[model samples]
Each structure stands twice: as C-alpha cells, then as structure tokens.
Target: MSNATVRPLGYDLELISTIYISHSKNSVLPLLVASLMVNDISIIAIDGDHIDDVRTMIDIIQHLGAHCIQEKNRLIVDARDLQNFDANIPECSSTRYSLLLLGALSARLGKSKVALPGGCDLNRPFDFHITCLEAFGNEITVDNRSITCIQKHSPKTEFSLPYPSVGTTLQAIFSTVIGDSRLAIIIRNTALEPEIDDVIAFLNKAGAKVFRDDSNITVIPVGRGSLSAVSHEPIHDRIEASSYAFAAVATRKVVLLKNCPVKLMTQALTILEQLKCIFYIQSEHDILVDGRSIEESDPISVVTQPYPGFPTDLQPILAALCCTLKAVSHIRDEVMPHRTGYVKELEKIGALISSDGNKITIMGFESLSNAVTVNVSAPDLRGGMAIIILAISNGCDIRIESFNQILRGYSRIISNAHILGGAISHEHP
Candidate 1:
C-alpha cells in the first residue's frame, strides 16, 4: 500500500481562492473505449484530464491494439488497425472500471477475457454486469481470477436492468452499439446520470443513434465500420466538485470552484445550503462556496440515491463534515449499504459516528478542533477524501495508508489540495 503524509498547514483564510477542476474522467473512460469500437482511420480526440485510473484505462486500450496517445488535456485514439481482444492484464485487475472492456471487446471480437477487477472494497458485485451481458445473449464463464465472455449469437434487442446501475447501463449500451446493427436495442430502468448521458452523446456523435426518455434508453446501432471519428469533451466532475465544496464547508473556507457542473450537483448544493454554506452561482459552470456560515447552520439529513439525488459518492465527505458540527446529523446510503468502512477511521479523529445497516447517525461535535496526530488507512476512494478533509480542516498531521485508493478516482487530489493550501505528500512503495 502507498502512504501519504499530511502535515499541518495552518489555515490561511486569505489563501482560499478559486480552483479549476477538469471534466470527469469517470465520464470519459467508457467513451474512450466506445470510440475504439468504431473501425475508422480518423482519430477520436477526447478532451479531459487523463490521469491515474484514466491513464490506466488508456494503457489497457492501447494494449488491446488501439493506437492511443496523450497530448496535454486531450487523448487521441485510433482504432483502425485494432487487433487484440484479450484484456487480461494486471492493470485491468487493479481498476474496476476495466470491466467495461468486457462489453466493448465482446462486441468488437466474438470473445474476450479480462482479469476480475479490483478497486475499493465497496462490496459492489459484478453480477449485474454479467446479467446485463447475458441478457444480450452472450455466454459468460467465470473462474476464480478472470471472466471470459463469448458472443453466442445476435444480442437481444430489448433488456431491462433490475436496478439502475451505471456500469451495467454502459455495458448494455456497448453491447448494443457494436453488436448486430440490424437490431434496435431498448433498455429500461437505465441510470440517467450525466456520465450515462455523456456516453450516449459520444456514441451518437460517432454515428450510433442513442436516445433517452425518462428512465429508458434506446440505441439504434449504425453497424460496425459505420461509426466515424468524433471528438467529445466530457462533462465536469460533479462528484469532484461536491467533494471540494464539502472540504470548504468542513474547513470554513470560501472556495470558488471553476468548471463545476452546478446543475448536475443541485442535490448536493441543496444539502450544502441547508448546512449554511452559501453558494454563488457565478455562471452555469462555476460556483463559489462561502462556508464561513457553516458554524451557524443546523445539522442536515441526506439520503443517497441515483442521479438528481444526493450522490452516494459524497456521503462519506458529508459525514466527515457533520462531525465538526454542533448538532446531530443523519445519513442513509440507500445506494451502497456497506460504504461505512470509513466510520472507524473517523472515530480515530474523534468523530462520534455509528451505523445501523445502511443508515448512519452522527453525533456532531467539534472533533476537528480536538483532532490529534493519527495514522489511518483509507477504506475506499471517497472515504480517503473524507479523511484528508478532516486532517486539513484541523491542521493535524496524519499518515494515510493505502493512499492509492484516492488516486483511483481523483488524480489531481494532491495538487488540488496544494492549491487549497494543504501540506500533503504521498510516497509510493
């Protein structure tokens, strides 16, 4: 496990200022792979900050025979001469998002094999993905370490997800777009997150016809070799934006987040407002958070749901902020029940928190002011961000084990913390 040391950098209220965050790479990865399904000599350029897991996915695609290159803020991919179909690599095993390769490669080639994915120990099962693939008439076999998928026949034209899972939705889309173009695929109860819409837009721009109505998504495939080259810029990272907003609130700093997707974060912004953190929507894509008023605010309640609801990803960060409040707060993560692994680590920092099933109750106290130097391991991605927020808010020295957990999602976290006047450094081993 990699470790990160966060030293106390006494808060300078004057140093708090605006920071620019790039578009969501989580929203970019599926599109990057989807671009490769198109057999075109024309280059597909994706504009975003590609680092950490995004870079890992790029490497995986290159290994699968796509010509991928990084040029500053853009990733250029040429899949015209694509050959390999196997993605059973160590890199794939390390990042869970690599599972999307199964669907993409299965459509491009008749069969594909990939190492079982690993990321945060969130207890998120890949069975939903396998179910979605099987719905498309694919044959799947699982070993202890890897999964192999083979196209048995033409994919099914209609399928409905038992739950609105984002990964499964993307899998269904990839399977349809690159499958038999004669079929018009219809998917019900699909996740309507901005990232899902972004992928649909990329597919449409690349010559596939995809439409979303309410909770259902319809894909009209344009057949293989018909999808031409296209360039797409992914939407800004709403989860990343919310994380910084929560940091500002936890530390009582005024932070202007540029390129933030204010609309996509309406639910999170509403919750922040209830906590007395004022927001100035400078533009459609920028928000200024005045968190100095948080002390006067009452504790708030949050329930995580799909898009347009308080995001489950921000639940841990909010729970951390609640610890610094003077009243009780309640949070229910209806999305992922086993996501409270960070509560124990937060307790080490003096947070009074408990969990019952998916419900969490936090007895708010001034834990930040009483924080002491501590060593903790990040339980997951957002959980690590929550830990760092507590340490930065309290100006407490902390050693965070398994720091790579944070890098899996937030590639620019260290640099962004530095911009916020945080004294943080990580050492890889």
Candidate 2:
C-alpha cells in the first residue's frame, strides 16, 4: 500500500503530466473571468497545469465580489476535471491570506469566524490574533478547532495590537468597521513587511479611518460602506515570483523572468549579489538572475518579517536553494519560527543540512544525484514547491504528497516546470 492513493482523497483535481512545463495566462484573466462570470468575462484553463498562479487567482476572487450575478451560474467555469465536485470556493476566510480577508469579510458579517487555518509546518505560537481581537473589546473564545468572535455585548468600540500581525490588523478593521464605524486601534510591533502598505492603502480607500505612523496603525470602519469599483492592478506576487526565480537559480542557469516586480526582491536579490551572482533588470516586470558556483565558507543571515523586509514565507525556498550553494549558509526564521524544513528532502538527494527552531544551517554538496520516486510531502506552499524543485532537478521520480499546498499559492507548477526544462509531470499519488 502506498501512502498516497492512486486517487487524490477529498481533493478537487489531480494532474498526470509528462510535459515539463507551465502555461502563462494574462495575469488578469482569472480575476476578470471569476468576478464577471455572468458578464463578458469567462474563466478557462487548459488543465490543472495553470493553477499554481496564486496571486492572479486571489485578485480575481477579490474583484468578483463587487458584482451581483443575474444568471450567477451563467459564467461558464469550463476546465477539465481538475477534479469532480470541485467546489468553486468563494473568497471567504483563509489562513493563507486571512489578512486579505479580514476587512472584506468583516464588511460582509460584522464578525467573521475563520476555521483555524491549516497550512505549512510552522508552530504559529503568536496569539496576536486573539490578543488583538480582545484588545478591540470583542468577546473571543478559542476551542480546540476554531476561534469564534462575538459582538453582542460590548459597545461598538476600539482596540489595539501589540504586534502588527497582518491577520490581526485586518480582523481589527473588520470587527470595528460596522455599526459605529468609528473603530480605532493602536497596532504595536505589527508586521511592516513588504506589500503591507498596499493592504493598508486598500483599507483607506474604503472610507475607513485608517492612519499609520512610524509606530502604529489606526482604523475607523465605515460599517460596510461601498468602496468605489476598483480599477487598479495588483502588485505582482513577490513571493511566487521569488520562488520561481529561485528555481532558476537552483538550476544554476539563467532564466529570464518576465513580470517579476523587481523592486520587492530587495532581500533576495541582495543575497544573490552577496553570493557574487548577477541580475540584470530588464524592466519593471523583468529580472535576469545569474547563478554561479557558490563559495564553501559563505555565511548568510536571514530573518522573516511582514512587508518591505525578508518574507518568512521564502525561508524554506531559500534554505533549499542554499543547499546547492557552494558555501555553508545560515537562515534564522524570526517570523513564523518554524524550523526550516524542505531542506530535509535535499538530504535524500545527498546534501547535508541541519535545523533548530527557526535557525537553519546548510552545507552544500558538489552535485545532487536524482531520486527514484522518493515519497515526499509539502508542509506549506513554499516548502512544497521547494521540494518539487529539488525533486525534479535531481532527475528522480518524486512523489510530492499534498500537492494541494502548492496549489494554494502557485497556479500551475507542472506546466511551468516543463517550461523551465524540468522533466516533471503530476501523477496520481
């Protein structure tokens, strides 16, 4: 008996592919199609192959909420069986992008209850969500499974956060935005990582009382006010772009990345430069990172934060990529505090690495030999794809369990891997 069944258990779609590849879609297609399925827009993809494109899909779902469907079912969601009974999940509460959902769901229901999100392998001890919600005067109850918020007792009020947890901050907005519409908070030590400012800007646009200084964020909700139909494009998914960019680096080859949103990669590009690698800025959306043989004694320091800083999400991919570098490297995961994983898979390919808590130490191998169908699993999105990158590169037949984790972020991994000349195709586990 195999750990993964020949069929995906309770999953919507599965892929069986041989083409080393992914297909590119106009980034806006999913948003346009899913949001306006009843209108001129229509959503279609060749197969499960293009599903790894995460950011585009997020943006599409967000935009779709504004319009009401006459023939709500008219929008044809035509695609091959990514799976049967594939429930088109409306954008609600998600652990992956819970921060993105906070204000939106709060607007829909004065209180939002997100089933405890499950992804990644991090020991998320930061009770910032509960702490922040309590500060906002909302009654919070945490059981084994989910955190529930109730507002029947407290006067519509305000609260503050000690840490700038992205999800907590968003939840604050959602809880106070309705009724009184005058909810304010002081967010302390909150995440100020890259792209968070954009999220703040979106809140401000919705007629919320949102103000941020060097220290704290304050929000006054408009009680489900109507936001003007937004017509702006989303910032490119820096995390996803960085993952694929690292894939090219892992290959020790030069692959041109179009639409890469180069500015957001300050942390990653800087590391590559410190490694004496080369990257040519082709355009706002294009970057060419040149990989070279790494040094044996190169020491690296990594810490995770919100936006405009090292992303915690990239820690796993960075660790995996560093495994092939010539030098011994170090990465400390200050954000989620998960011991850097995914690199363990590299050991199966003949690399040496060690991790404790959030800290990781990697000793690169001269070359990684291929695997012969190693049973593997993806802890989270980044680590999942990182494993796939290492697996396919080693020319081993890899069984990546829980590929759905990869799908939570990337739209299509198999198709893109093929495009990058990787001999990867999905199989029924």
Candidate 3:
C-alpha cells in the first residue's frame, strides 16, 4: 500500500499545497442539458466551481427558455417554464457546447439560431458536427457567422460516425434522449473519454439507458420513457490535475493534488513515469508527486491522440518541460496542428524550438535568462499555460496579454498560483 504521508520540498521556491481541481466544463455542459431535457423541475447540484465556459453554457440554456438559478456552483433549473423555443446564443459564449445545444434544442425546441462559438484557433472544422447532426435528421445550415437548425422530423436511431469526434457523439446522444417516441441510438466510433462516460452516467441516472463498449455507446429508452430530471456533480478536472502534476515535476517540488481522479489520468501518468516522476497514489481521491528525480529521465517523444492516449491538452506543457530539461524532445500534435503556433511565442522566452507542420522539435537549453517584461500574447488556453510555466521556471515575472483565453478553462488563476507560492497576478489592461 502507498503511504499517505508526504514530505515538503526543502527549496525556497513555494510548493503546492493541496488543491481541489474544479469540475470539468466538458462534463458539466452535457449534464446540464441532460438535466434540462427531462421535462421536469429539478436541481442539478454541481459540487465544485468551473470556468467561464460553464457559465456560457448556462446562459444558453436559460436563453432557450429554461428558468435557472445558479447558487455558488449549484444550478436549479425549472425546465417546465420554458417559454421560447428559439435560442439566441451570444458571440462570446460560443464554444463546442453550441453543437451540444443544437442537439438538445432541436429535440426540445425544434428550432434554434446559434452563433458560431469561438475558441482556441485550432482551425477545427465544423463539417464533422454538421454532418453528424444532419445525418440525425437535424436541418442544419452552416454559415460563417451563425448556424441555423430546424428539426424537420424525428431522426433514425442508428448512427455510425466516420470519426470518433466527442462533440458529434454527444450531439447524437443528446438529440435522441428526448424524442417523442421510443428510440434507440447506437453511436459507433465513439470517443471513449472519461467525460463521455460522465455524460452517459448522468443520462443513465436520469432514466436513460446508455451502454458503453469498446468503440461504441448504445443508448436506449428505459421502458418507452423520456428523460427525467437529475442532480449530479461532474468529475474533477483531469487536465487541470495533469497540468499541476507536470508543473510539480518541472519545478522539482512536491505537490499533493486533492480529489484527483487517477484512473482517468492513466495515459498521462504513464508518460510522467517515463520522465522519472515519482508519484504515490495515496487513495482514490488524492495523489502525491515528487519531482526531485525528474532530471534523471531520458528525452521522450509524445504524440497526442484521443482518450487512452496522451491528451493534446497537455502537449504544450510537456514541450515547456523539455525547455527546462537537459535533453532534446519532440512533440507531435496530431490532434490540432494550430497548437504549434505557441512554439513561436516560447522562442521569446529563450526556448530553442521549431515547428514543421503538426510536429514541434525542442532543442533543450543549458540555461535561460529571466524575461523581465516581455509582452506575450496567449494564442490559446493550453498554450497560455505553457508560456506561464516557462516564464516561472526561468525565474521571470512576466505579463501575458489576452489572458481571458486561459479563463475560459481555468478558474482562480492568480489565487491558485499564489497558494503554490507563485508571485503572479492578473490585471486588465
């Protein structure tokens, strides 16, 4: 058995105290809609806090006519009071969640006009989303500015997605759950992400039948029944936990992350083990990481894939780690080619990096000078975190512009950093 006791680092640099990672936006948005579609008054109790994207999803849900009250992290939604079927989605609130709204709104309201959601400039095309929804009988028109959806008729229950796109898969499940009659949905080539499982669990708990297999998820109505209201808490943010883990390793500190769902982070933990990271799984809810031996590991090459693989979300942080280490490393972001743009920004902080297409080559440096006041633009969320880690590791206090990009995913940034003994602050310019 792993010992629960942990020792603090002797270095003057601050180490992370225990931290409770917030609920995942990826999990919360789907659960929010699943709860709303049950056609009843219900209280969806969210346990932990989340970022701006969760709030954006809530606003969209309210605009679609559900009366909702948000107290701290809990949302009390009254779906019976829905007045307007047409949804008015704001531009700033645009995200992949909009696609999920399309599925849920088409089932509940039958029509919606949602603006295209803005996110990291990954240049991910919406064609896959449009294709999957269109296959499910949702009349969708794709325009540069907005997407218009009208449900002409109930769709066929069977679907075989060309790719295991998480957004598309969720759209299928959300649309089918609230149909007028008994329906069965078979989603093949599904994304087996833990967040997807959380959605399935939420729906199943609320009187929907969802089964998971190797590469597919099947959803069936429970005894000719529509969805019912539910109260649920999203799983802890695995990406957030992984980010702090990488930070602990790179900074050579000891950190105990609270409520870290280690089972969901297997792939990431395997990679960390390869990096000579010493970790103790204290319990189902916590993990102790000692990064003192991180310098002993060999250079590693990583490729980003769907779940059960290295997450694309952590690729940038790993690249940042290569900067602080003594070995050359290669990171291939097969998931999003646009993620490589952050490599250019890291150059300003004295990283020897170059990119060719989707792959990034990092030539590790012996030493780096602190950047006193270099202006850095946050190209995306994970990229923004990468730059911040690079700056702090080099003993530099820097200002990052466009930091709201980070806020879309992470909450209480300055506060969390301060708790970890980081001298960081955020201000609007």
Candidate 4:
C-alpha cells in the first residue's frame, strides 16, 4: 500500500527495510554511573535513540553538580568539577536507573539523598540493590520519600546476590569501583546480560579492572586517580532488533534488520524458527526475515528468562504476534507479571486470548477485522509496542493513548513505521 510494495498482511517486502534503532536503555544509565565514579572529566560520545530518558539522565547529572554538553550523539561530561553529590529525583525523572546514582555518589561524596527510583510498573524490587550497598559498609535508611546512603568505611571484598539481577550487579560494581586501590570486590550470582559485559568493558577501558570468573564478576579499584578518559561505543540494541523481527512476523513481511547483534539473539532466533517463520542470518550483524508464508503448526511456547535465554523485554511483542498465528501460543513471564497488560487491548480488536497470573495463552485467528474505531492505553513501554503490533497485524486503525510510553524505549518509532510502509499517525487529544 502507498507505493511501498504489494503483499498480504504477512508477506515479503519487495525491498529490504533498513531500520536503525537509537542506543540501548540498558547502556546509557551505566555510562552515566561510570562518569560519577571517576575524579576527572569524562567525555562520553554516545549514539542512540531514546531522547527522553537521555535528557532525564543529563538533568540528574547537572543536579549533582556535573557539567554536561551535548551535540548530536556525543555528550561531554565535566565531572572534574563536581561539587554536590545529592541528587533530587523529580517526578519527571523517576526512572529506575536513578537508583544507580546512589552507588556512584556515595562512593565519591560520602553520602547521598535520592528519591526512590521509578519507571514502568514492572514490580521490580530494590532489596537486591540494598543488599549490594550494605556490602559497601554504607549506612542506609529508607522512608516513604527517598533513600539515604552514608559511606562509613571500606566495603566487604565479596558478596552474593539472592538472584542474578543486572541492577544489583551494577550496583555492586559502581559502589566498589571507587574504593581503595587494594580493594577487590567479588560478586557471586552476577547477571550475565551482554549489557553488563559492555559496561564492564567500558569501565576496564577507563582504568578499572573488571572481569568474570565463572558466575562471578570481580571489580578491582586501581585508585581514586586511576581512571582515564576514553570513548566507548555501546553494543547494538538486541531487544530492538528482536522487536522488528516479531513485527515482520505479525505483518507477514520480509523485513531486514541491519546491524543486529545476532550472537546475543540466539534464543530469539530459535523461537522464530519454532513459529514456522522463514528467516535467515544475512551476516553476523544482519538478518533477513521472510514472513510471507507463516504456516499453521504446533503452538510455540516461550518462557522469559535472563540473557542467553529468552529475554523478558521482548515478551509482549512476541505475544502480539502469536495472535496472528494459526495455532495457540503460550508465554510465561516470570520477570514481569504486568507485561501482558496489553492483551486486553488486543482482545478489544477481536483476539482470542486468556491469562492466568504471569502465563498467557493466545489462540490464533485466521483474520481479525474491526469495523469500529479502537483506542488502546499503553501502561508500560513494551506493552505500548505490543498494541502497535496488533494494529499492523489486524490492518486496523488504532489510536494509542499515551504514546510517550513507547518513546521511553524506542527511538524514531513513527519513522520506522513509515519506512516499513505502516500507516501510523500521531493525534493530540
């Protein structure tokens, strides 16, 4: 339609659709935390898409008495002149990453007062991070308003997390990387997410020694003046690439995702194959997906897990695609219970779906046709993207309220839709 190529809802595009996503939400926050650990000014040249979250981080940095200047994708952070360590998390800036600032500030400033971190209602708890900070020998107090951290002495050299949590592992690393040079922090049960590996590499390049031995991440602080300014490029967004692939499956188009990190997406690729979706790896960094002939087969089952397993982040989009398949599909999300909030929205447009707690079941439909106008609410980031997939698969007009929810994770989404020949428009109510 609209001169883009002719194909059924789930067919191959005549031309390859090239989409470039902005930097990852997982990368930007850690880079900001790394800047706080150093005593010297660090110039970070970052490239990515999520502008709102980036702006919020920059504001938090400025609030902490660090100077930041941005031009295009690069940000120059002048932390050499940092004066204040206390960060006030405004409601507009209530992101979960804001919690990591506590570890960075306490490591350098001796104390910090930060509001409780906020973000998409994912039911994420802070007890794991609290355990990491307590291992730093810091006195912590929590009230309804904010969290207070006061550093007292050198932290314990080793600790263990109740679960392999990325945030907690990062907290352990950030809080200890600024300790005495002789101190080595060992964390057991550390998360093995690729993003964490990239953050470790960035810190290592900045003069800190961070390595992995088995299931542990060890961080050794070289000294207060050890870090050196360095430019780093974050790994490509694996979640974004997977989202595009799922979109292609739902819409039945041959879409090409360029510059994808195929190595990190093995589980996603395996699930795609199970769905009877025709896809192939064009290269290590590219994938060509032919959704033209999705066959009705056995129901594909998915269980969300940490990295190297199926990612919890892409669960919603994949679930949306299940609605378009010929057989019933099942998804179990142990990471986030509310991740399926968009299912009701899909049902509004004629989808056969049911849920029990964190598990969801979707019965495929031959086609979904809606004559009446429909409006969907996006309560979270991934859920917002799910409804958009529904619109594409159903070939129906969908008005998404609070579209900004999707912006927190996706960059240039409207442009991406246009490039893929999707009819998506924004309206102010």
Off by over 4 Å in 4: 1-14, 91-93, 365-370, 427-429
Residue-level lDDT of model 1, residues 52-144, one tens digit each, is 777788888889888876776677788988878788889887788888888888877767889999877999999999999898878999998
State residue 201's C-alpha deviation in candidate 1, in Å: 0.5
Overall lDDT per candidate, in order of appearance: 0.81, 0.54, 0.75, 0.79
Off by over 4 Å in 2: 1-108, 153-160, 179-184, 226-228, 292-299, 366-371
RMSD of model 1, in Å?
Answer: 7.3
Tens-digit per-residue lDDT, 1-429, candidate 3: 776977895434355466677777678877776665667755665654557677777787777777888788688887876646555456433566766667776766677667776677888777777877787778888676678888886676777887887787887787776664466777789887888888887787778777888887777644323556777777988998888788777666677888888888887788678887878888987988876767543887999998888889999988887887777789998777678868878887777888999999988643455535767888888898888777767665667888988888778666666544467667865
Candidate 1 residue 244 Cα shift, in angstroms, is: 0.3
Candidate 1 residue runs with Cα over 4 Å from true position: 1-15, 41-49, 295-297, 365-372, 419-421
> lDDT score of model 2?
0.54
- The candidate that achieves the highest TM-score relative to the unseen native structure: 1
Better of 2 and 4 by TM-score: 4
As a whole number from 0 to 100, the lDDT of residue 367 in candidate 1 is 37
- Pick the winner on lDDT between candidates 3 and 4: 4
Residue range with the least summed lDDT across 10 consecutive positions in model 2: 78-87
- lDDT assessment of candidate 3: 0.75
When 3 and 4 are scored with TM-score, the better candidate is 4
Q: TM-score of every model?
A: 0.92, 0.73, 0.91, 0.92
TM-score of 3: 0.91
